[model samples]
Target: MVTLEQSQPKAGERAYAQLLDEIQSGALPAGTVLAEMEQAARLHVSRTPLREALRRLVADGLVVQQSPRVTVVAPIDAHDIRALFEMRRALEESAARIAAERGDAARFAALADELTAARLDGETGRDAYYDLISRFDVELDRAVANDYIASALRTVRAHLVRVRRMARDRPERLTASVAEHLLIARALAARDGDLAAHATHVHLHNALASILANLENEGSA
Candidate 1:
């Protein structure tokens, strides 16, 4: 006896998903005020559900409560990006090392081939490239098999979407990233934990450098 209400997502959950997507996609850019009544209307939800959604976003650090009645999207700057990379480096490096030792070598070898042949020319190609990376991440997570580290990585990845959008225009960085990922995948395929870890570190270092440089360029522009 499953009722429609039970089968469908709750209003709060739906609102939260929509708001989270908008925030991450920059549709609701940082520092944009989230008025209760207005957002409820815009999202077509009641005030209570919208409040529930806002609370979740606050916990996620995607929004900030300015007062009892005011909330705004969180701002990301160079400092925030650096802190994010600091956490990412710690988590991803360890994950790569563990996965290299325990993961399916054949699967990683296939991923290495995919990375080697990836195309990132236009917007469509870029989307496909990102999809390939997502698949690689899925495999890495499955190989690592650590809930705690995976949970932390999920949080870091949420913010990373916004950060990635900032540097999406830099074709050079994208090209280098493909090479970096190829090295990591090859290391994992070879079951070389040290090499996987070191490759992950270098990849993160280069990625952070490129992102920061892009931010500086934008600021100067």
Candidate 2:
């Protein structure tokens, strides 16, 4: 038997997060039909909250409801994915610059906390490393706190997560990722917009190059 304790984020939010995670992890994949009844049964939740959650995803451009009938995952392609992550780099770098100017100590401290955990992971992790990276990325969004930029960042992050498991697993790649993120953090601390923005561009460029290289290699082999 299990005890029912009321929780934070309410039921809709909880379901939304779980479903979002599933989609991001590639379990749900783009273009998969998501029947409401089936999802409610699978998630062990009522249809109302699940529907609400789906609506949220739809608005976020992660899902789409068809005319008079079915709901399916949104179609995403390599070009779209590239554009989204590139937008993230641009938006987040600008935010980091602003966050530093605003003197948001708590935000920086929060990032430090997450980085400390990533450092403890010591390189690769099937689970912990990603968890750490996710936290750091979200906080980077928070540190900015502009509504428009934040909205775009959130959307981009969610979309990118769909491919992140593939992007992040390379050991050599992961090592460099940590170092670049560290540079961004250091720049933010010093309130250097130019440095923060430049470092972020370099970081994203490197990540894009790595992902492209791996993908190209996969195609050849």
Best lDDT goes to which candidate? Answer: 1
Candidate 2 structure lDDT: 0.74
- Candidate number achieving the greatest TM-score relative to the actual structure: 1
Give the Cα lDDT of each candidate.
0.93, 0.74
Residue pairs that clash (backbone atoms under 3 angstroms), model 2: none
For model 2, give the RMSD to the true fold.
4.3
Model 1 TM-score, all chains together? 0.94
lDDT of 1 by residue, 1-221 (tens): 97655533488899999999999989999999999999999988888888989999998889999999989999999999999999999999999999998899999999999998999989998999989998999999999999998889988888898899987899999999999999999999999999999999999999999999998998999
Q: Candidate 1: where is the Cα deviation over 4 Å?
A: 1-9
TM-score of each: 0.94, 0.80
